[model samples]
Target: MIIIFIASLILFAFLYMVSRNKYDEFIEPLDEKEFKIKKIMPIGFWVMDKINYRYASKYDRNLLNKTAELNGGVYAHYYLRVHWANKITFELMLLMFLLFINGAMGKTDMELIIFSLLVMAVVAYALDKDLENKVSKRRLSMQIDFPDFLNTLTLLINAGMTVSGAWTRIVTDTKKSTPLYSELRNVMLEISNGKSEIGAYEEFAKRCRLPEVTKFVAVITQNLKKGNSELVDILKYQSKECWELRKHAAKRLGEEASSKALFPMMLMFFAVVLVVVTPAIAGLIGSV
Candidate 1:
């Protein structure tokens, strides 16, 4: 166990030395929350680059891109690389920690080694699952906010505003800093920075990856391309549909909250039972 620990430690130290500062300028600006274990990310990237590992398959790459797009189109590729790097770095770190613990405790058994490997595997799986959960949460948030945004846009357009003007107004005037609003703000920024209006909206839909947003973008793009006379009516109808989606999203959140509370409630119930039963049982024993 000590030998294994020393070898793994040396290997990681050497790898870190070789990979250190290789991508600092590129990685320093990443959000610590999204790109956790940030200190090891450069090393992970270096290892990935050296091994020429893009992803396991095209489907894997696509799957990652679907979630990565939420960050931004320009950074989609970076996030994909970082996602894999984070997973690799976390698993390697866990392996080293497990080996060190086993060595220090002087418990060098084959079963311990096997168990450590399983633990590392589970950690890797959980890390990947974390990314999926992040995307799910972002999606739910955007869904819950979409109906209000649609309604506001409909009002602005009805009040003698152009589609672009209404969009800019909504993004600029709104104070809520949510994922949906942030994406809307990005769309406005892109358009103002000389990106074509239709192109910006299309990118927004791709980033959102929601059916309602996609349909909304299609309607807007059609309006931009062919000048829809019924755009307001279409938006109002979509807004109603989004309200339904929002309700479902809210219900799902409530369900999740209840489920999370269930375990604690059960624990409290058990605690109360023990507290009430202990004195009675003790008195019975003393009397006997």
Candidate 2:
């Protein structure tokens, strides 16, 4: 048993080292300037510290930042936390399962430990899939609201407000009620603090990466450059298209719900008929 425990520890250490190195290979370090900026920002600082503590290397931080950059860089901290937490949770679960299996099977500790590592690998894969699904759902919801947001901007612009002024008005009016509203509000704040409208819009597009938002930004940027006056019409058309899409989505959801309920509804109907006829059938049999 003692030898087994020693061997298990060695194996676990080796695998952990291998995974850590692979994670390092996947990430490139940020420059000294970016690293310093990350340290100053509260959220970035937390993410950096968390990654360092969990991963025991700077490479983990790079991996997380790269992943976030790939997704548009706005939610890097959130993604890092998600990935770290998921890995920790899976590891803990695997450890517990291994301990349980060892006690039940009277196996050597090393065998159980190896089995636990295998389980953790499987769990990590499943957790990644679950996270992807969640992110996709959130992106879809944000996209659904983009057209209405664009229309609101267009209306404000047409009514004699400057683009910045229109965004400020919308920010006040929205009061951050929706996800899109909050994101827009942040963009507005960025603009208020000296960022150019075009730069802010570009950042917003990067964060969202939705086709509608990209197209809207392209149109607005062009109009700004060319002094175009037809933005209001374009906004109206986009709004109408988005509304139609939303309606279609709603209809589809409703049909899916109805289809799912159909089976239970038929079962209930048959059950009610059987209950009503059973007594009459018994009475007729008694007469016979």
In order, the Cα lDDT scores of the candidates are 0.87, 0.65
Which residues of candidate 2, in runs, are more than 4 Å off?
1-78, 107-119, 251-288
**TM-score of each candidate?**
0.91, 0.61
Worst 10 residues of 2 by lDDT: 34-43
Candidate 1 has a TM-score of 0.91
- The candidate maximizing lDDT is 1
Best by TM-score: 1
Count of backbone collisions in candidate 1: 0
lDDT of 2 by residue, 1-288 (tens): 444445655655554444443333223343434223222123322333546766436866765544453344765765565456445534543565566566566656676677677878887777656556556655657767776677788888888987778878877877555556766887888887999889998888776666777877887778787877787788778778777776766676688789999999999999999999999999999999
Cα distance off (Å), candidate 2, residue 167: 1.9
Displacement of residue 69 (Cα, Å) in model 1 is 2.3
Per residue, candidate 1 scores C-alpha lDDT tens digits across 170-286 of 888899999999999988889889999999999899889899999999998998999988999999999999999999999999999999999999999999999999999999999
